[model samples]
Target: MSGEQAGWALELYQRSVLKQQKFAGIQSLLGDTAGKRCLDIGADNGVVSLLLRRGGGDWSSADLAPEAVASIRSLVGGRVERIDGGPTPFADREFDLVVVVDFLEHIPDDRGFAAELGRILKPGGRLIVNVPREPRWSLVWPLRHAIGLTDQWHGHLRPGYREDSLAALLKPWFEVTAARTYCKTFSELLDTALNFGYVIKKRGQGEGGSTAKGTVVTQADWQKGGAGAMKALYPAMRAWTALDGLLPFFKGYRLIVQATRGSD
Candidate 1:
């Protein structure tokens, strides 16, 4: 890939197949955001925040990682903040919507943070969340462990979430209005293999203080040559990723949920 193409690859990293699935899932529930006040939390690759912003919402983003804060700001370019993992800096009932992605499972005080989510949203505000769903019975478990993508390495405080358990975590002030799973068997298989390759390439590299937020949270972790290699193979990867759509019978490996804030 040319240097320009490599830079394009870096920008497009969040456009991965799995992430596109999550974005489609979110947009299905999100509908119109033209006049809404939205906040996206978690240090996801900033792609989620970018996708939502395209809906024309007044958007802001926050993360505990300085790297993510800088990265996300470069994309969304408005009101990205670096937080310290305490109470957030926004005002009470300050937002009409909040989106959480690949993040809740990492918090040591998740319930407390759920309260914080509730505290910042207006009555009847919307919440959209995406999380890993790695139940013990999941067929993907063996490969996941084989690739060194275990919860410990990913900085997960817990393995992941089930629909019920995740609902419980958001129970304090949100009512789950919709729930579903994505990243089914074929997709999981493809994603795991891709992750293994990245892990193999990125092996032994210092985590740049990202271990606490998950080691591979962004494609930036793929770095120079890794990004170029990924850009080269990206077309085949996208084609491989498309196989998942043909088989709906397989159980998925991640969950996307839509919820609404409850009245005080």
Candidate 2:
């Protein structure tokens, strides 16, 4: 699949309260990238690539999925490439910054990937990573399983990361400059419930049930309503996100890291 056609479905649901907060955090951590060479690893749909490019960073994209690589290339008009799960194809110290957002959980050799990220970054260059926090809150796991809202459908290898564990994993090659956990708000929880119902309903219809007269339903078609729905609800989502910010007692759903490569 070409880049433009890749990840269209996923982007539809990207505007939930949790995602809005996550992107805000990512933008804040990114700071000023003007004139810097930036690489977005696992650039799903090229959202980060576009964001960095808009910030004036010289951006490139890479992904293991051909569709995603194509989508990113189409979006950014840059050097887009497909990567195997092994070592990255870039030269040593090739970029001033690297981003791996919500991509670590899918890779089996996370340590090797971390090392590769370090290798491809110039000394003192930055690496920004975001991953889901695992074990979730005490209530979340039960709620998710009870409702069949699991992430297994998305091919998540592991649940997510803990702050200390993630720190330990990257400590060998990078210094953790900053780290934080972001809590999900009530509105996001409501959104999840609604998505749970939607997924269940879709699954019940069987593989071709979403299509008309036995026709196959494409991913984009299945998700066609998401973007418009999210757009209409964005103002309310932002308000919920702001409210979530005030509730420090909630369990965090995501962990964001800002680290710098150590001297070789």
Candidate 3:
């Protein structure tokens, strides 16, 4: 990843409500990680790595950028490696669980990466992946661009995914066990508006807007007198989250899948 792309990713991991939701989904899927050998691919700020470690798992992290690797090291003392868009350095069948959150959409050769993921997992090992759902709101891109909220600079190569499409992509090496979508219409819209407002406020204050490397902003950042816009929007976001629970049919902005490596 380029420096700008790395910065954008760090900013998302630091401040994006979407990232927090994704993390929640991952934790829900990853119950009782104790003693599991877990690998977190594309670990932006090592939040997942930290979580896995805290669960008593042996956790390792990998990112395509050295800067991101350094940031992960700072956040969690662990085995962190730099990977290109090719095979990773890990030995075959090295891990019991692997995570690829918000990562597949960014790869150009996703098939090759999937095969590599298969090669590194123990028999019947689990793979949990999270990606944006298809039919992404194209209408919001121009506005996001104008406000610097778009991730175009962060190497998002594809638009998003459909359940069938993503399943097909991973079918050759894995079996889909569970799948779910998140960020329903109301919550997604509110989250986007909150992010846009925060960016605008930061720009107005001459703040760079992009998060600095190694600085992982948490909920405390907003609650403890961080960004006023985010603080103001937090309550509404909570309400939207509650409403989303009541309406399950609405198409969400992201897809989460849990699969098992084919024993073949």
**On residues 1-264, what C-alpha lDDT tens digit does candidate 1 reach at each position?**
244423543356444666678778788888788888989887455666766776897989997666677667766676998765569999999999998877777778878888999999999999998888866586777878876878776778887888898899899799999998888777888777876766665565643333566643444555556556666777787888778779777657888899999999
lDDT of each: 0.76, 0.70, 0.71
The C-alpha local distance difference test score for the whole of candidate 3 amounts to 0.71
Judge candidate 1 at residue 83 and give its lDDT.
69
Query: Residue-wise lDDT of candidate 3 within 194-263, one digit each (tens)?
Result: 6665565566868654431212344333343554554455666666666877767666778999999989
- Looking at model 3, residue 10 earns an lDDT score of 47
Number of backbone-clashing residue pairs for each candidate, in the order shown: 0, 2, 0
Give per-residue CA lDDT, model 2, range 42-151, as digits (tens): 65656556656768878878776666666567667768877755687899999999888767876778888888888899999999999878744555566766675555
Which candidate wins on TM-score?
A: 1
Comparing 2 and 3 on lDDT, the stronger one: 3
Off by over 4 Å in 1: 1-15, 204-210, 216-223
Candidate with the greatest lDDT versus the true structure: 1
Worst 10 residues of 2 by lDDT: 208-217
Q: After TM-score superposition, what is the CA distance of residue 31 in candidate 1 from its true location, in Å?
A: 1.7
Point out where model 2 deviates above 4 Å: 1-16, 185-191, 194-223
Worst 10 residues of 1 by lDDT: 1-10
